[model samples]
Target: MRYPAVAGMFYPSNPHELIEMIEHCYMHRLGPKDMPSLGCYEKPIGLICPHAGYVYSGPIKAHSYYALSKRSDPMEETTVVILGPNHTGLGSGVSVMDDVWKTPLGEVEADKEFVNLLWRECEIIDLDETAHLNEHSIEVQLPFLQHLEMLNIIKFKIVPICMMFQDYETAVEVGYFIAKIAEELNRRVVIIASTDLSHYEPQEIANKKDMIVIRDILNMDEKQLYEDVVNYNISMCGYGPAIAMMRAMKELGYGEARLLAYATSGDVSGDYSAVVGYSSIIVE
Candidate 1:
């Protein structure tokens, strides 16, 4: 079984506290002030969320989750395939966990059948726990999903894939593999790519650099997004997952993307000297 590593740190360890934190995030809705009314769209197929602490990035992440919650009803079958960066540099290049994730709320069972399908489809993807054991990127997303489940907005399973090698080709391969599998299974799956933007830079610089990444995301240019981040030296942690999500959306005939929110830690701490950037996006 996989255990919570960042509990009580990144977020609350107590169930009640965690729920309250997430609720507060949703209610607060901190980020870009001039956001246009998020109109209805086709069923959400993917999301790009941040993985920072709730106090820093939770509000941005909430925008994506709240938008998705609005779309999910009790009648639909949803499976969330969460792809997170492997921050600890452990395990295989692409690690897939086949075990229950123990959170303070309860146990979230891994989708073994989907894991097996991905393992069979990709040589780079492996069934391993080392990457997940000490990683927070994937772990942080679970509680938000659990909160959604608790609200009865959506009941869904999860397939958590952690990536240590975030490269252009790897992202594409992973994305197309997921697209093929979902089609084969005739399932409705949402790919949630967890990432944080430029780290420890001035707020203005962070926003400028993150916009480069966000522009490609909005344009649905996966290769350009991947290349621009690397070439420009933008320190986006989950560009690989973002590219993969974009590719998967493209494969599924999704051509539109919506920018939900963007902000920096300085917005919270009131220290604009050096801060991490956060953003939330949806690709449909």
Candidate 2:
């Protein structure tokens, strides 16, 4: 069983409060919102979201799920593959769990069949739950998904993978492996890369670094993303997962990517001296 490790800290521990926080995220919107109409895209293929505290990043994350809720077919058999950074350094290079994840909202069963197929196709992936035991990057996104289910928008299982080696080569191999699994299973899959941008930097510096990372992602240049992160010292925790998702989308013939929202913790706390950046992006 995968119990929530950061519920009361990163988000609310109570289910009601959790739902309220997510609902409040949807109620508010940042300016110049340009999400496509409901039928604009057949569905969302991948998302890049932040995993910071809900108070600072919830609204930005809402754009990722809101767009998803609009286009997803409620009746389809869908599985969300979430890739997060392994901040805790406890498991394999790529750890995939085959257990139910428990949150304040409820339990989300793992897509074991899909995950097993992934393990077979990718040599890097391992069946390990310890890495996720104390990690919040992937856990923080569950309530948003649970809220969607509560509203009857969509019901789906999950494939949660945590990446400890955020390197471009590993990302490519993993991305292609995911694409192979999707093709083999012929299932509707949505990939989510969970990451928070520049951490504890002044707001201006954080934005500058994050913009570079965002540009590379929008350009769909996985190698460049890795190079920029290293060369420029961008503190994007999940760049490996993001690059993996980008490579996977390209391999699967996806063409467009959109920047839904971008904000800094300063946006909420009014403290620009040292802020963490957050952004929401979708690839299709």
Instruction: Please report, in order, the local distance difference test score of every candidate based on alpha carbons.
Output: 0.86, 0.86
* Cα RMSD, each candidate: 2.7, 2.1
Encode model 1's per-residue lDDT on 48-162: one tens digit a residue.
9999999999889888887787667646657789999999988999989889998888889877888889988888899999989989999999998888777676777888999
For model 2 the TM-score comes to: 0.95
Question: How high is each candidate's TM-score?
Answer: 0.95, 0.95
Off by over 4 Å in 1: 29-44
Worst 10 residues of 2 by lDDT: 31-40
- Residue 155, candidate 2: C-alpha displacement in angstroms: 1.3
- Model 1 scores a C-alpha lDDT of 0.86
Task: Count the clashes in each prediction.
Answer: 0, 0
- For residues 1-284, could you state the per-residue lDDT of candidate 2 as single tens digits? 88889989999999999887787777655522433223222653899999999988988888898878776766665789999999998988898998999999989998889999998779989988888899999999999887877776777899898999888899988888888887788778889999999999999899999999999888888999999999999889999999888888887789488899999999888999999999999998
